[model samples]
Target: MFNSLISYLDSIRERDPAPRSRWEILLYPGVWALFFHRIAHWLFGGRLFFLARLVNHMSRWITAIDIHPGATIGRNFFLDHGFTVIGETAHIGDNVTIYQCVTLGGTNPTNGVAGKRHPTLEDNVIIGSGAQIIGPITVGERARVGANAVVTDDVPEGATMIGLKARSTLVPAETWLREFIPYGTPCDEPCEPNSGDRAESLERQIAELRAEVEALKAERRGDQPHKMSGTNC
Candidate 1:
């Protein structure tokens, strides 16, 4: 058990550079939140719903991270910071890293059945700060959801998603091959309101359109002389 705890702390250290030692990592709110979640989840599985809820509330109050007792979390799942929410039916696989203010939310079903609504995150998935991954979608292994992204669909393996209503961008080979990307975003990629390549393409198009407009205006001005001469004739 001590070895497992050490392993988990080491995993966090690999992802985050701020922690000086394992003891500093242990002081993190995310670590405490996960610890409380384990106790809560065990009680919940034993059908002690009230006790589970009680523990969940305590964790939330202390860590400012709310993880439903019914949520299933795998080994070495890391919540990097606080103010994150994990829904009741959410399932997180091993080595999933979630940043601050991220939400693994569920969609309400009209059929009155509280079925599987929350998302399932596969192993090595990274969710950036303020990302909202809603519905029963499955985020595939090594998928990255960028900061402030709204993802309502299933993310393909090794895909990098960004922007509102998040669109998947082509992951560069260097970025894709890296073990851990800070904030689920590639520093090499331009962090813009739109996808990096797409935004550059749009700018090129706008420049070409402006040049064409200028050429058309010049041609119209030159034709004004001919029109005036023809009127005199």
Candidate 2:
């Protein structure tokens, strides 16, 4: 328990580039909210439903974050500018980073279904500000949801979900994680020089990766070179 608390503090400090003292982390609303969440979750697990909800409500009143007691959040989770709503049955994995106004909400509020209604985030997922991940979809490991992206479907591992409906593109999230992108901005690669659209560049890269994989497979089987497709290729 002590180890978990220490790790949580360390994670917030490390991920946030601000030079504030470690003592300031102790006063963080997210820290306090998570602290209350732990106690509430313990009570909920013990079948003290009313008591658990009471604590949950208290935490929400104190901190603007609204995380249900039933939600299972893993270690090293960071919530920036909290107003994040994690619904019941939402399962977040370790090293997840969520910005303000993000919602891991349910889709079928009136379906009367018995199973899980909230989304499940795999390890190292990063959700940008104002992003909404609805339903029981699984956000794969190391995936990223760009700012304000409404994701109702499952996201592939390492993919970056971007754009506002008319031009949503999925690229390798791991690609931009290598470079430093400022907080609250759309996740995009700064190194790419082509037309300034990071998604286009990543799409080209994805196509190249596919071609390389095919080439490698063909080499092992002693087959002829497979033709590569795409604008750049």
Best by lDDT: 1
User: Model 1 over residues 47-145: C-alpha lDDT tens digits?
Assistant: 999999999999999999999999999999889889999999999999999999998888665455788988999999999999998888999999999
lDDT of each: 0.89, 0.81
Across 113-141, the per-residue lDDT of candidate 2 in tens digits comes to: 55787899999999999998877889999
How many clashes (backbone atoms < 3 Å, residues ≥3 apart in a chain or on different chains) does model 2 have?
0
For each candidate, give its TM-score against the true structure: 0.75, 0.68
- Model 2 pairs whose backbones collide: none
Candidate 2, residue 114: the lDDT equals: 53
Over 4 Å off, model 2: 109-111, 165-233
Top candidate by TM-score: 1
RMSD of each: 12.5, 15.4
Ten consecutive residues with minimal summed lDDT in candidate 1?
182-191
